[model samples]
Target chain A: MSAGMPFYVSPEQLMKDRADFARKGIARGRAVVVLQYDGGVAFVAENPSRALHKVSEIYDRIAFAAVGKYPEFENLRVAGVRYADLRGYSYDRSDVTARGLANAYAQTLGTVFTQESKPYEVELVVAEVGDTADGDQIYRLTYDGSVGDEHGYVAMGGGAEQIDAGLQQDWRPGMHLADALALAVRQLGADPAGGEPRTLTGDQLEVAVLDRNRPRRRFRRVQGELLTRLLSSEDPTADVPVPDEDDSPRASSTNPQTQRDSERDQDRDVDGGADA
Target chain B: MTAGPESGRLPSAYLVPGSSSFTEFLSAHAPALLPSRRPLPPQATLDAPHGTTIVTVTFRGGVVMAGDRRATMGNIIANRDMEKVFATDEYSLVGIAGTAGLAIELVRLFQVELEHYEKIEGTLMSLEGKANRLASMIRGNLGMAMQGLAVVPMFAGYDLIEDRGRIFSYDVTGGCYEEHDHHSVGSGSLFARGAMKKLYRRDQAAGDAVRVAVEALYDAADDDSATGGPDVGRRIWPTVGVVDAEGARFVTDDEVAGVVEAVIADRRDNPGGAR
Candidate 1:
């Protein structure tokens, strides 16, 4: 065929094509939910791999959750950590904020979308637990670097629309940790094709939180018996131990070996009170 | 990862998938930021403040580390209340004794190093791994150490794997030596170690550990002019840190003061400390 006179594709068409490709890639992954509770922010992801994490702590009070290709989002996660650490080192510990990190991620994602060959197929939520409930902030960044300042709750990845709808129907302000976690799991199990919801156990889900009651570094992972108890108990909050100010129990009160064995059994209960 | 256009985007080095080490990243991207990279005058015997007398004693469940509040410049006291003890992370503590300014800067870098690794890898470094990382950091400072500026730090932590408290000491050349029971570093380390040898007991409680550390510092101050004893008049006390299954925390001043008063009162009875 004679070289077709170079047909020009408009900028808008090219951008739309990239966006569609990225969205489709992201939608193939499992869902992640982030919501604000009475004490702090809770992150629940339908991730079964203990070694590979979908949620991580970025700074003193900031956390990150993402859904998409693991390697791609992992790159962004590491980059976010570097930015926060470098900034905190250069300035003060309090200087690192989720908004600043979200802005940096936006810049990187936006640049890559416009400049690189393939856009990153990742959607991220950056949450910071503030001093008060009203002060909590969550920023959602999409493939094209657009930001949404969401309040209360956010869901992303495959079946996100359905999960978001479920969260909207049930999520309320200042729910207990157990109620919040149950709501997230229920929503994550919602079927996109309008089928019956699947039940997710503690092993099948990954959970963590930015506990406002914690002293400086507020991020803590919830797993093992604590996760099961939170999922099964009717009054989980009644006996749920808030992590001490130091993030661990008093050294003199418990035996080291026993503490370690219990912690191993429970995985990581950030509240530091699961065994108690 | 090249030096691309000057834009608001993150440097390629930060985005590149690579090692979890923060210092390594800083070295590759901003070599000037590393404490060991600063160029010093060759063969220069610079007069700088030197912190003295850091002691670490293992209790039943954890470790207690304490440092006297003095930084000396030759015959003069450069700083009366220099903090030489720092909680490196939740489960670890570090006490520095060397060039005061450089040592503090090294501690800061080491703190960031551990924190960066934890955040990147989603787990705390093994106690041995942390000690090795600190060793390499000190090795980097060998360049400055050879020029009469050195940083010697005592590292103590509650090892989850080992299920007990552990201590690690380092030399000027970054040789990491695991010390059992108790250890000390600084200008007055000799005297402090002697006192600890007498007072440190196996399976001591946390309160006993604090007492032993303070007593060790007191004995060091009595013999070494560089070390400072508890200053009751100014209400200045030695900084104490405890690391155990619960994590690391600094002992409150009031608590340290109570110990200091008791030690001083006991010293009034015997010129020399307990045998």
Candidate 2:
């Protein structure tokens, strides 16, 4: 007996079908924002899990961020770390670069997209900050293995177009970390020009940065009381004065209703569709 | 995994759950790439230059480690400016004694090893953990040790957990022993250790501890021909490192030179060193 004849799918149709499949798969995940601040590059992702990370350090200066399927992006992140460590060991530490890592991921994703029946549903960003503001670099790699060098700001995942448009209006070349983080959170929290905006608290957001001011290692996470203070400090309606340098819990707990009122006010402000 | 385009996409080793140790990872993926994996001829004793005399001492708040600048091959001085002491990390110092080439390579590998662990685990290795990792690295070089090209390193670090300084000394066969108070290794170690025993005090200040280390090194240089004294003419002094609760810091040459001058002036009078 002979096996059934394979269905003849046209090359054009096959390529289109794969592209649509990958896009739809990625469109299901939440968005991530990567931008260049005065100090270095920063990453903001909408993730609730404290254990699972969307942003991670790949080397001393380079950082990796991703959005889409958790397992797929997580595997890519681990592989990037392994690659960077091996290269640094075999050569010098200065030899490891984000460009090389981006190209490597492109090769891997390109192979899986063309050769395999199902493509990897993941989007990645590899960023490295040089000693100066002009030296910062950010690379965005798509599910189909296309890599693009982004300038001041780049957004990925669902509703990226609207977020990018919002970032385009507010992003500056040399904003401070606090201002830049505020801009990112505002853009991530609000929708386009006129739409209902979502309220994302510090607990729902994951943020990190590749700070050039740091020594050899640049990547560091921003979370806990620091994140809350950064967000609340910028919001005018929060009505809560900036916490002391100690960042004691007593200050935040002193006025639970005040904090909730501020959050609820933000919800109403976004729901009202008031443009920035 | 070193799986180039020619090898499909990734090496089979990439799929396997590898060890957290970078050395073990290298051994599993590419054995020949490892420094200790290489073999030497049996019964052959190489005549490579060997560095000498590393000493470490724990004082009130922290520790001091210093090494003489000398390397010898047979009866001839191979190098006069060999740097035997290296800052392994932010809080740790390593001083090498034994085969010069292998020792330097080992130090570099150990640095990478610590960094690799920190990156993988997102935490700094403890002082004891760092010492044990180094001991295993030296153990991996057993093949070369048997060929008379041994590498014995003295490790010292500020223990974050214990809130004090600690020292660990290793033998050629990879035996790691925690040295209390102070310890020394290499050709001139005996003299250096003797000088330390006489001058060391449990309540010595940071500057006093440094003075004691310089005194011990001067004694080593005086007794052992392989060890070198401070080179006032060339402005080359023994490399001195201090590790406190703050972190590991190198004593600037200017500062060390000041102390050397003071020591030289005191030696003019007593010749027997400060009691």
Best by DockQ: 1
Complex DockQ per candidate: 0.27, 0.06
- Residue by residue across B1-275, what tens digits does model 2's lDDT show? 37475633444354344455777777876678677988887898879999999989888889999989889998999988777887777678889999998887788778777766766666778999999999999999998998888999999999988888999999988899999999999999999999999999997888999999998999999899999899988987888888887676678777889988999999996878888
* CA lDDT, candidate 1, residue A261: 30
Worst 10 residues of 1 chain B by lDDT: B1-10
In CAPRI terms, model 2 is classed as: incorrect
TM-score of each: 0.90, 0.86
Error of 1 at B84 (Å): 1.4
lDDT of 1 by residue, B84-186 (tens): 8877877888899999888877877888888899889878899999999999999999999999999999999999998899999999999999999999999
* Tens-digit per-residue lDDT, A152-247, candidate 1: 999999989989999999999989889999999999887889899899999999999998876566788888877798898664452246654335
Consecutive 10-residue window with the lowest summed lDDT within model 1 chain A: A251-260
Model 1 clash pairs are: none
